[model samples]
Target: MEEDSTGPDAEVGAGAGRGDDQSMRGLVEALARRGELVDIDRPVDPRFELGGVLALLDRGPAVRFTDVKGSALPVVGNVLTDRERIAAALGVPKSGILDALSAAIASRQPTEEVTVAPCQELRFPAADVWREVVTPTFFEKDSGGYITAGMIVAHDPVTGHRNASYARIKPLEETTGFVGIAPNHHLSALARSAATAGRGLPVAVTLGSHPAIQLAACFYLGLGDDELEHAGHLLGEPVRVVRATTSDVLVPADAEVVIEGVLRVDRPVHEGLVSEYHGMYEDYGDGCTLEVTAVTRRADASVQVILPGLAAEHSFLGALPIAAGLRHALRGFGCRATDLAVTLSGGGRVDVVVALPPEQRKQAKRAILGCFAAVSMIKQVTVVDSDVDVWDAEHVQWARTSRMRWERDLVLVPAVPCDRNVPMQQDGTVTKVGMDATAKPGDRAAGNELAVPPRETMDRVHGWLTSDGLGGKVRPTPVVRGALHGAHEDGR
Candidate 1:
């Protein structure tokens, strides 16, 4: 069936139902065919080389690097480059992103089973192929190359349900790497559960799969909600998975590289000063170590790289989270917020702009506070009336200048919890500012004031004089006599 590209159903149709034969490679091929994929032939290093490419592709399509120093396979990056590309990837209009993403989340269902998987096309007994694969080149002064794009898929040992998470892995040896799982992240929670059971947590880190699956991994799903199932929901199809050769976890059937391993609970490795999404560097102490028992991949396969602290990476990572949170918050306030946008210039998730009806002015302020609460990283929010387009910066600025009053409409709340990267904050706390840019209700009727139109209207008499052949006989609207509040006026 032909899908409507401008609606929510189109985005949902991308993930409705499908099989294992569709791999990450297939999606890349489709994007490439659509002229949404660019390949760089010049030799580029993994560290700064990929960053430069990502900057160019930030508002465009995915990039494929065919000429890395020592790698025979290509390295693709920036699959979800911008909001427009994200809309294209999800099959929705750019303005309908929040609605489409929320719909996908609401319609998520459990994943279906599959027997044979393409990801297991070739298996290497940890010793053979582990040394051949190149580690991700994210930063220049890092201890070693890290796997920044791998989605570590695991199941809760207690509940037996699955989860997917994006975590960085640093190669310590040929068969061992340090996986940094944040303290409160889902994978970390699962790891803690396994530790209580006196066993290592089994996991499979899948690399270079479909963009939908990658997005699903990054989504912050609630407890018992499977990310793989969410990925299926996003793709408008079910994802195919096969049981790992060495672990109880399931990996994507079309994944390029699957590193099946177990997280050693007792053993830990020093991890940080790694680059973060905030466009800053932070040192995270000791992270879990993974002992890779087996490695699976296709022959002559390409790897994916994620550039940290950049637009392409941050936008793709932060878009849905910010949008979904804003949508939920605005709805909670009983505001008819039709659209929400977090600018890429504001580090992808910090500065937000919301569009709502002008009559609901109080709801706008509540929506702003709700956004700040939902994503603590956001430092400033601007609420615009529906008459003023939020997506257009010029229109937003116009509304701010013309409609807003300094003391009457601006709301300031101090000492709120802030993200680590906010420049104006002190020790993770700062003052948040919200501007109510909606037009003041009944300003004209309140006798505040009104300005007269500067242009003079022409009558039929003037029109006849200014008619095509008689144009020179008539003069245009006379220039205004003087400035309303000038020190001096010149008579013409």
Candidate 2:
């Protein structure tokens, strides 16, 4: 409800401190104190063990595993598995999540405190600690074990702006790992820019962190914006940061695990078949390698794993991007956009349904095109009148059937930038389709029509049926017959 701000008492909770020690770890402990955390103490395998836990915990509570196979330290996953957890993490109601997230995005300011922080609680310089700290975990079938949840913190060489993002880390050994840098993702773009100047970029991959930091890393922010500030906005406080032991980049003071490294441009390694958010495995060969400079962690740390092809992963990774793009597109087209939902049915990113005012029929087409342009992954969009609830699948389908004419209402755009998971991409190109299912502004058949008795009459009918013990046999309303049946009744 309140706008974003930063101070000693930045309203993290009703009365919580905004110190470096009060990071996501503190929030999790608070949730645990409130009985919101579920600890799965049994020994679980890392391969599918975390994924299984995530599937059960989806939209539920955060889980902490005390006994991971071959490790005394616990493994924590599904911190942001559902809307409720995300709301809890942000200290907001689930219904108001988008607004709070938008507020966080809008109001972000970097911290000026230069004191040593908790993230540097235990530091291992690259040369001294590379082999001892950077441990890799395998997630998929054909890919190398990766630093699945690593947040790579770096500074843009040209602009000298700090950037933090999530990228897959493929293990080369104990100290060094290969990073899969996609072409469009911000970190990859930054790496390319630095590489062109023939300089290796310094980076730190934070393996375990609070949900706020993870959410911030997943977001697509501006070049100069500090994700730590965004994390503070999400948490409704200022995020405390500490300088990395080897690199100049700053990381969350309370992060569970941190790997300070340099991404060497000259040396690249083959990294492939890694699981992606698109619910598919992508083969990215020889992207870049992160030469580990330092690794730090809490004394009995917990490893965090992101389950690939999971609901929470898809929703958190895709929701904001789609929502921002859709919001911008609808507003740009002069349509009174009431709501937009990216259906989980389409892996939480591809299929979207937008609700708009009935009068803005033509604007729906424009909104659809704008959405496609904004988020390249969206393949199909259905526009419905505001009366039809976009969140209701049955209502949306009914509107599509009743109001949409495929030949006349469907708009097709070809050779669009498709989601990498699209099975039908010829060469990174795909087709997008938009269906205008809203009723025409002045069309006589544009509205829903139902001929029924008054509420009292319906109630009386129901009462009689129940009194006679024929409730099961009685229909709520009569089914009208054709003209022939009506003629027969008239003749009788």
For model 1, how does the per-residue alpha-carbon lDDT over 1-492 read when each residue is reduced to its tens digit?
Answer: 011143222332244344434455655666776677888999887656677677766767788988877665688877766555556556566555677667666667666557777688788887643454566556665666777788899876666867888888888876888988767677877887887888888889888777677777766567657888877766777777888898778888888888888887578899758766666677767899888889888775778777666566656567665676567656766776756767655666677878675457668788888888777778888887654545455656766787788788788999997655564678769998888876666755664222323323333444556565674455321111111111011111
C-alpha RMSD for every candidate: 10.0, 9.2
TM-score of 1: 0.80
Per-candidate clashes come to 10, 5
Model 2: per-residue Cα lDDT at residue 20: 37
What is candidate 2's lDDT per residue for 190-267, written digit by digit as tens?
Answer: 777778888778787776666666766665566667777776766555666777776677777677777787887578
In model 1, what is the error at residue 290, expressed in angstroms?
2.4
TM-score of each: 0.80, 0.79
Off by over 4 Å in 2: 1-22, 30-36, 56-60, 125-140, 333-336, 359-361, 387-395, 418-423, 441-446, 449-492
What's the CA error at residue 406 for candidate 1, in Å?
3.6
> Distance (Å) between predicted and true CA of 47, model 1?
3.7
Residue 303, candidate 2: alpha-carbon lDDT: 67
Question: Cα deviation of 403 in candidate 1 (Å)?
Answer: 3.7
